[model samples]
Target: MLHIGNAQIPTCGGLTRRSFLQVGAAGLAGLNLPDFLSMKAAGAVDESKAEVKNCIMLFLVGSPGHLDTWDLKPNAPADVRGPFKPIKTKAPGIDICEHLPLMAKLADKYSLIRSLFHTSSAVHGSGHQWMMTGHGFNNGDPHPHAGSVIARVFGQKSALPPSIILPGKVGAVGDNLGERAQTAAYLGSAYNPFFLGADPAKSDFKIANLSPQAGQTEFRINSRRKLLAELDAIQQQVENASTVAHDTAYQRAFSLITAPETKKAFDLSEEKDSVRDRYGRNTFGASCLLSRRLIERGVRFVTINHFDTVFSIACWDMHADGGSLNNTVQDYERHLLPQFDQAYSALLTDLDERGLLKETVVATLSEMGRTPKINGKGGRDHYPPCWTNFLAGGNIKGGQVIGASDKNGAVPHDYPIDPPRVLATIYQGMGVDLDQVMMPGPGSRPIRLIDAEPIPELF
Candidate 1:
């Protein structure tokens, strides 16, 4: 069993089954593969309809520098154009970073929103809140992560948790801001997204949350469950709202512990070597492949945080300062670009070949973009004024660039779209009707999925 703070979970041997139950109560939606098809057979969630049901969100934490990656400006002055040259894609007049060669080949598979912006503090957590929850509220008044919201609204379809975040949740981003926004704020802890604490790329990888204790036998687990049932019986003597909640939690615990596929979902060795190579046998790349796996098992919203921390490791936030957070253009060409291209392209191609692409919506999002012009450090500064994000699969239109940035790759010259629209568009693609399907919010008020409407063009 791996020790996580106070809990010594029996994760290694039988933890996946237990962890699945421990996730939450009555929260399910989004199913994958055998489970999804089984549900379709059982008349649960339909697969024949062209509804966008599953999501694989690639959260580019620490944010990618817009100038170096998506919004390349080769014609600008030497400093403005930066070091890398822009390469044309299959789509005419649409150029991306030179290092994204694989992505260039798959340009027709996704649509780029070249003008996504948000008005939030330049701090990473603030932008995370804005993009994650569609509102940057504080801990005292937290908002649900987009995945958590989907969980609360739709409900689970299989034993796997409805919402999941791979490689763990976001942590310390300079300040002690609301890092737990990945939770269901006023919606209660029962709706939080299930977090995968271990790195998928590691050779000895195991889902930390799914590992069982060293000496924890299945019989012992079953015995403990019975004891909890009896203790809950004692608590129910004076039954109240909280007691009822405890009962539901207990049931969820047992259900997960008893599920077999929950164990299968975390078993990467079950995949072929050729498949693993296609996803690029790296941390971020493997995580992307796992996201597809979880979705295939009935997970609703699967968020793959490309990197948990922006420091030390090669990430997209090309600060270029020779320090902890430094990420130069060299890193982009050799590490970040190729890693992302290989992984993302593999995900799209694999999903399409497996016949899952048309039923799932895959999105690439970031907190915000970097400056339009180059910085003194030979990189770009934070720029909330303009950036780029993309959406594909499901009901979204492919082979299109809906918005445009100015000549310098600065602010939007036309059709200035913000982050909220991205979330709204995702909902629309996922078969969610914002005008209907109201979710209970604070004070038991029925709140719309999001107040904003989905971008019509994404359809």
Candidate 2:
């Protein structure tokens, strides 16, 4: 038996009962304590073997159209080409929409993948599953998100969670089939991405999850901890692996609540007004700024959902149906493109200036691309055949276009890249050796993190 304070803990298989009790107690606090314990048990992360220290994933919820954005066809018909004209970027042959002027100036900082496609359904959820998890949903066996996989492999570096999603989790958005992909899935709940349920852009923004309850003082919290420990001592009689996992989560929650560094990490007020303004004052901008802060504070991965859903908003899903989903070219020009251009460019510049770019990988991804031709509603529809996403910083070479589409911007005219390959490339960029590294899959079976090989050209 092992003793902590006034409680006596039994031993099981060389592990003290007090440790298991603490894990169960921490689990009650809503932190995935078991995940850390599991990683320690499996020896997943080896510091000597680690490569990239961090990553920020800017997930554009609604797919952007290739013709209207990156791979614009200036010589195509008026309806097919859309209104915006491509302008020369800093990189010699590359040009993007005129609205993305800020991004155009920083062309040498990033590389565009013009031929990303998947053979899955065109629904938003399907693409979400594929792009986020690197796997198509097979019945209900959803794959773990890339971030969750990272969290599982590396564990937390500080009191703050390793994987975090800003603004909130993706909801609704046409279908819910792939929504589960955002979760830890078979890797277990301990590796789930920490979703910041509040908007940082708001004047009254506060992380409700990180803040203590009203009138709850440090002394009171400590008293409650003691009480919980006493209760855990009693409950330890029925202790099991699940109970230990719960206790571990509670321990993590307690650490987060009391840790000044965790509070400082999430505090945006520390940033200058000018700095905040540079990223833009909107939700997306604030999220981008927060992502930088999180990365600086030892978060391995931060995912910024540009928008939580595609319905009833001026999102990239430019169906232009003139209904709840009425997003048109005007919205893109006046809002989406400009907002993204500022936030993205600012993030890259900020990271580069802070010298974090070399240690971090910044990636922009979407579910799919918009259709090649314009629709009757003056907008493009979903097209899973082809689209454009980009990568920058870390080991990724900048200012180069990897793949190409035909004149109509319809299909992959050159080297065809799929969702898994893109994900594999990201892992590779992060210094993960796909051949040597394996993750624990369903039924505790060891399995490859991803099946596809990384893009050779990227190296």
Candidate 3:
């Protein structure tokens, strides 16, 4: 009988009741992409120039250990060094985990920020808020995800939604501490990121929201629009001002459900088998390929959440606890690393082939990293003290890494950059002057789109 906003949450459950309250309120601002697309169709938003625009984010759900992934330690002790070895990358001096061979080959195209840290709460939600929204928060005040912010500022492009979260939205991590950064907070429900509820990796892959029911035709749709128009006339008399907004919302819903181009953007069948194989036929891999399709159709932002749940899946959290969450180095080698390597390299190659590389930025990020010191279970615990995240393409400078971590990959030794700088760099890469573009706050106050400055070296 515990209450979280309007939703009832289990009070006696493992997580706190307060967390459930946050969860209940989280989905309240959920957005509809088709509705946004329909609005675009009605000329509600601008689609002026065919500017080079696109972004694909690979969000490693469970934070990967920096020492194991981007920053390897061969000289350190056996326990500290862990299992993976460093392999020389195409970037010459740069070396990444051996398991990521495909990524190593394309290392010249991407840069790894070895020195990155934030002293936020050492929880998964903390990093999710940080990497996803570019700010750290202890208070439960929700913030907009970078993609949603992009949507609020740039609006929709063609029939596709401006911001999209692939496969599914972020759910309960280990903690109920709300990951508010993913929501479009004060921007309202109109600007929330579109959540693709189904997994792209499944053989029966389909965008549930984009799918139309059998026998539903244009004639039926047009009739529904007429009916809605009549209803709008009635509502107009009851609430004059609010009627316009509600009508706009209704039209948006129709456009998405009836649009042909929007459906194609979500259809994987349009892609070649070889292309699918190149991206790796797995969940994260297929999602990357789908992102490319969406970008081709003018989707402004696409995020591929690596995995939805960290409990049963063999995720990046290598806390080999010998239980359901027990993910060892073997899991990284056998599945995660290779899959990411293939998908990421394929996305880079594909985007470059289509000449979208210069206009699109690909960011590989995580919540945080594992501890510098190995735990008793031969796995590393959560460590936010230091880690690594990287950006490529768009206006980002590749080939050379910007920062460095100390020995054993413990802390930032030079140019300690936080998460906001990374978000700022993305905005800059997208040709948005962080100083120029601003969004409205709760009280209709103009708030700076991002409070931080872009990493100069990234450009």
Candidate 4:
């Protein structure tokens, strides 16, 4: 018998126990196998009554103003209405910002939720935690992201991870904000989303984590796999739940490193020049394109963050302070709106043309809506009292508004929606039964996936 970590391997059939143990022990310490195993678990996807097979979430890092974008107030005063005018869409009675002309043309493909409000603090992080995870971090009991919970419930669809966040992770927005909101939390590390640390728009783009280090070769990789296989064989003889879970994780890591399809999935070059051009060559555009590729390749969920930080960058957080975080209305006109309109419209049209729209739900989410009234610096401040987000494709009814803001776009007028309801709608759209499906909670006890019910009107 030979020992490797907490498991034992049998060597009597071939080499001596001492030599086998020596070789196994030599390189195992550097493998970092436990962390990989802790990141994923195997479960069957229950698609018996699912309306959609996948989802692509475009997270607008900074919140957009309802009055300026979806819920326009044309009759209001200059400061209130700002400068942008609303344009008619294909859907009658629906109008959006003139800056979003492309989106207006496709209005019938999605629905807007204008009455979304939250009671939490009006901070960027609070909204991120609420919108991303469906629940705010309570005490130290952080909830897993909606995507992570989905990954846990449905499991992986293929060699690709179940849930993936493109471009990079959100960071440096505010104090005590970025912690654990994007992580797996109590669901354990296995359900955490795989973040593409590098920007895909770069010409020399490559996933650093996926590529092998210098001097590492396929031959050496295979040899390590062989050794792990022997160790796994021994463990199976005395298999327990934990051991089985570890095996699944190790197998996922092995596949990711060696599979040609894995590399092909991340390759933007495979896309035609025309298609890439349509998506634009910028970071957000490339990310949107890559998201489609990933969904096509079997990833269950893909999230594209429009901007990772609001500091010194042109983002949706239009606080026209004329300082470091000086994003203004001009930013929306020249950069933000155009960039979003191009990339987002391209994604919707491309998905529809490929016949993916029916099986994939595209959602545009943000933390909070900007203040209804413009600030002193000619920008809108954070407003959690009211905002707007939207959904399209799958079973979501399009060309209609689900809720509304007041005359001033300050509060919900009717059909008021909250963050949890939005998340519940997404879960239902993805064919998940919130009532029947449960995930492992704080202890190993099974708990309802979400406390809220799906928005019935979406169906």
Candidate 5:
């Protein structure tokens, strides 16, 4: 019998499956394998069937108004229609905001879902929970982020974490509860999205978590690993499953810190200045560019939070309050729309040129949409009735709008959609059979990943 930490294997021969699956301290701390890897090794998952291998989720933290952006009601009252004029695109009958000219040209590369709505509270936190996790958990049993679910199910392909979120996690957006929605709640800490704490656009951008301690060298790290191994052996016997999951999380962190390839994946300096300029060289743009690099390097899931917060910044939350959260139409016309147009269009072009777009789905999501009627303060407020989000690349069929908003853009006038259906569609596009695959729910029970079916129109 061969005992490797908590994983005990019966040794029969040198070529036995037990020996092949042996996870020693070095394997756990130095090699690239999460809990999902063990499941794959045991034939629990077949990765070969996944047609869409990767996903790049660009989460627009503050929701953009459906009327002002994708679903323009040109014939409606001026108050409901807003200021932006619609422009034609390559895809016939599809016209987006004039501010998104670059995106307009590439309309054939993406599809819009203009009638998405949720009946949850209109608060930003509730919307975040719904769109990101596919379940509204105001009752406190929060669900995991979609990327975290992917990390747990798909496993890692390289030293890079299976899921990576660039810039940082979602921060304060009206309610404090929205921030926790970005976490892996029931899926455990091991599958949490790897938050890139620093801005990649900065001149001195560095991944702090990937760097070793101030006084630590390779030899010192190795020495500590030996000591930690001795301690982990004793700790394993008494700790619960949560502790074991924490150890797996630590193993992932250790592998990332020691691996040279992982460091190179986060290095923006290697990219040409021209490419960086094409991505716009700002925080959001650079993050989008970095998402491509990470995806190119075998990251299964990459999330780029366009803005981490809505306070004291020019974000999508257009309250026009004349103070903090004072984003107006000017912000959209100047900074928000232009930057998104540049970064998003560049992402599509770069991915397609590199032949990655065919295998990687890029999803643009948000908390919720702004109010259909323009506010007295010349901005829009939070409205949970309807909004727009989109998906492109991968196996997604582009160049068409799936649903529609009413004449006033108040509610769904056509095919009404919700958050879970969107997530189910994304999962199906990733080649996951919703009927066959199930997640390990709370209390180790088998439960469906989502309760809804995929949007048939998407595929």
Candidate 6:
């Protein structure tokens, strides 16, 4: 929580999120939030024709095994099936992991894409680049994230950034080159997703970007604002894209930092204790709840990274190597599965109850799927050849499985789907005319946001 002015937004423990961000002893120009808040040139699109107005993307950082989770091959050999059992859901013929009982109950709300696969390198970074940006960056020309594309097309609807990444941005995941794909590359920093550096789950959490430096009084911050205005006057003479971008960033930052309503939007204390408990009290759960609040307050896109890295911590990367990369079925049964089941289902129910689901799309994605076969250490490894991802709400039809995996859950049995098509479906579901809308491409040329079309079956 941050104390912006005389007003204070408290946490559940009665701590305040209201405080001046001590940007740095150097100056306010070093404010990192404004840097990510920079706006790019808005894309060409007819807003009146759009179907979906908002999206909440839950990105599972460490890819979960499709066989162990959604596409269970019960008849397969003992070695292939793992420990989890599949249970029937509300959606006919759709079964999920037993650990995900809550999500199983709401199966009618989301549609699973079981045949999702990519032929790119089998690295975490490459998968992240493909799923997050809809393009592989091995060729060097990186594309903007899906949220950045939305920001470029729809722009901001309120003081909040058009696109936001909750908790924090993706950090080291082995392949730094591919992991860098989370940013808005050719689309420019203006369209970059705003990363919330602090975790909302923590009682002591405070928005670092909103607070002024330690020992700095409001008078000093205001004086710096005046100084910045003077500097802007001198810089205005240039009147180029860079100047316009910085000007817009500063304006957005000041507005977000000073607005009471914007501060309230970040306040979890405003929510009922039962509501918070329903979403779960962990990092991922709090993020999901925060996403709903953000969408309600006019954020166009909100992406929740379930975990920042696939390291020593318990995550979906169940390599079971008996080392730092180890994560076994126990982790899934005890933590990962239940956490996701609770938070995801709560998000769907909350959004639908608030009437936001009809206009907002919720997407569950991952870097890739784990190996179909169990490993020597009782876990699975990364396998980019096949996986599962799903979409719900908006105009997307539910109670249906869009594609299928083979008996062994190794590859697509029918109607294989790829990453770009998924991104296209999201954009199309949001009501963007894929054929009519074109974003500014590399070198200021007009081009479609994605090369592939939306999956017709999804609609």
Task: Name the top TM-score candidate.
Answer: 5
Give one digit per residue, the lDDT tens place, for model 2 in 1-459.
432111223334465656667657767876453343443423346556565768899999988887888999999888889999999999999999999999999999899999888988998999999999999988768999999888766667877788899899999798888779789887767677889999999988888998999999999999988998888777756744455545656666787799899888878889999999999999999999999999998888999998998989899999999898899999999999999999999999999999999878898999999888999989999999989999998888889999998888889999999999988988888887776566667865557778999888877
Distance from true location, Cα of 84 in model 1, Å: 1.6
Candidate 2: residue 119 lDDT (0-100): 87
Candidate 6 whole-model C-alpha lDDT, 0 to 1: 0.82
Using all chains and alpha carbons, the TM-scores for the candidates as numbered come to: 0.86, 0.89, 0.86, 0.88, 0.90, 0.89
Q: What local distance difference test score does each model get?
A: 0.76, 0.84, 0.77, 0.83, 0.83, 0.82
lDDT of 1 by residue, 163-238 (tens): 8899888775665454866887755455678888889889999865666678888888889999998897777677
Worst 10 contiguous positions by lDDT, candidate 6: 2-11
| Per-prediction tally of clashes | 22, 17, 2, 2, 0, 18
Stretches of candidate 4 off by over 4 Å are 1-40, 48-51, 227-247
Better of 2 and 6 by lDDT: 2
Give the range of the ten consecutive residues with the poorest summed lDDT in model 5.
2-11
CA deviation > 4 Å runs, candidate 2: 1-44, 227-244
Best candidate, lDDT-wise? Answer: 2
Give the runs in model 6 whose Cα sits over 4 Å from its true position. Answer: 1-51, 215-219
The Cα error of candidate 6 at residue 456, in Å, is 0.6
Model 6, span 1-459: residue lDDT tens = 421111122334554323223334213655233232232243223456665788988999989888888888888988899878999999999999999999999999999999999998888988888889898885677889999888777777788888899988888677775656777777667667888988999987678987667887767767777898899988977655566566766766776666677778888988999999999999999999999999999889999998888888899988999988889999999999999999999999999999999899998999899888898989999898889999998989888898888888889988899999999998888877676566667875556779998989878
User: Model 4, 332-389: lDDT tens per residue?
Assistant: 9999899999999999999999999988889899999998889998999999999999
Candidate 3 weakest lDDT stretch, 10 residues: 2-11
* Candidate with the larger lDDT of 3 and 4: 4
> For model 1, where is the 10-residue window of minimal lDDT?
1-10
Residue 253, model 1, lDDT: 55
> For residues 124-213, could you state the per-residue lDDT of candidate 3 as single tens digits?
888888888887664677778888777766766566777888888777678855457677776666567778999887988877777767
